[model samples]
Target: MKDSENAVDIKLIFQFFMCCLVAIVFLSSTYLEFSDYAQFQHKLKNKNWVQKTMEITPQMEIEIFHYRNHQSKIIFKENQQEIFSKSCNGQLELICKYIENHEIQIISLNFYTFLDKNTNNYNEFLLNTIAFKDKQGQLQTFPYMTDAPNSPQYIAEIKTEFRSFFIFAFLKHLIFAIMFLGFNLSFNVFKKSTIKLINNLIITTFSLSFISFVIRYFLL
Candidate 1:
């Protein structure tokens, strides 16, 4: 009876350990995806504000560069020397300003793609509307989009751009964690097995973990 109880305890302990391992692995990966998605959303929300600020600035030229990884660099040039550069999803906030006739011309601007971590996809930076505040502190917006903002084409484009990110971030992780826990518990059950049961559990756990990781990598 004592031996049987000890065996059961060992099995439960091992199961708990494997469960913890899976949680840690998935948690870390999910965190990265969450971080990227958050930054992506933040940039999108601020896109309009940035464009307006840029439009309000005086005597400035802007150039955008796209990278293979789907990131973009926006450079602001004044006199071709006081160059201000910022990247999409970067830690630094977009702050554009210039002193003209002793008045601070605080402005913002830029367009850039956002990468979706799960699907390895991204959105194209489209030139939308430009906005700026007038001398009376009233905001004015000008059309800059190729298509009308209310047009079906423009609405469709925005909708499809970030469709997969939220689903993958919330749904996929939950499914994977549930599946991992189920498999880990099943693999740890060793009723009537020989002394090699522990070794079998170890090998099976490691193999499953590795396979899961590979699948996730390819999915990304």
Candidate 2:
């Protein structure tokens, strides 16, 4: 019986080591992907023109497309206090009227495909946030930009949700399903004296993972 127990303990230790290796790979890959995404976002927000508009005839519906169908649409607001365009609609009205919240049909994105083309784009990154006023005159950009070490929200229209394409925000929350077990096992290994340390590790991991997902889903 003693030999059998010893064998089981050895197997468990091996499994734990394997898990650590896997976790290291996962976290490292996540960081690298995040770095690439940050660069793409920065290019988008640092273009020459922050915003522009195509003059639409009054009361016409405008179908806006950018970077190959990063899309949204709105009807032109007739007789409204228009800017730039012959008639205003879409993000323009929503922004000018001070519909300052994210109640409008706008997606604050953090990640984008930076094709080596399109130097004519009228957008740019001011302090990590992509600042562009869309056709509807709405202030466009991702809500939260962390490309810089200590970036803050530059505009007021978007709520600064800090979405990225990592999917950790949406999918990784379910990881708590199994993470707590890992937590418990780690705690038992230290004979309960390092319980706090284990818990902190878990919390930090989950928080980082959550932020990663937010950036992945919204930005990338």
The models' CA-based lDDT, in order, is 0.51, 0.45
Work out the TM-score per prediction.
0.31, 0.38
Residue range with the least summed lDDT across 10 consecutive positions in model 1: 93-102
So what's the TM-score on candidate 1? 0.31
Residue-level lDDT of model 2, residues 1-220, one tens digit each, is 9798778778777776776676667666766766765564455455332222233343533333223444333323435532212112443444423323434433332332222345744333232222445557776663333433222233221224334434553444446525554645643357564765666777777677767555554553
After best superposition, candidate 2 residue 82: deviation in angstroms? 46
* Residues 120-210 of candidate 1: C-alpha lDDT, one tens digit per residue: 6644454453344555666555344565433457555554654565455545455555555455455434453532555466556545644
Cα RMSDs, all models: 13.6, 12.7
Measured on C-alpha atoms, candidate 2 has an lDDT of: 0.45
Query: lDDT score, residue 104, model 1?
Result: 27
State residue 47's C-alpha deviation in candidate 2, in Å. 5.0
Q: Give the best candidate by TM-score.
A: 2
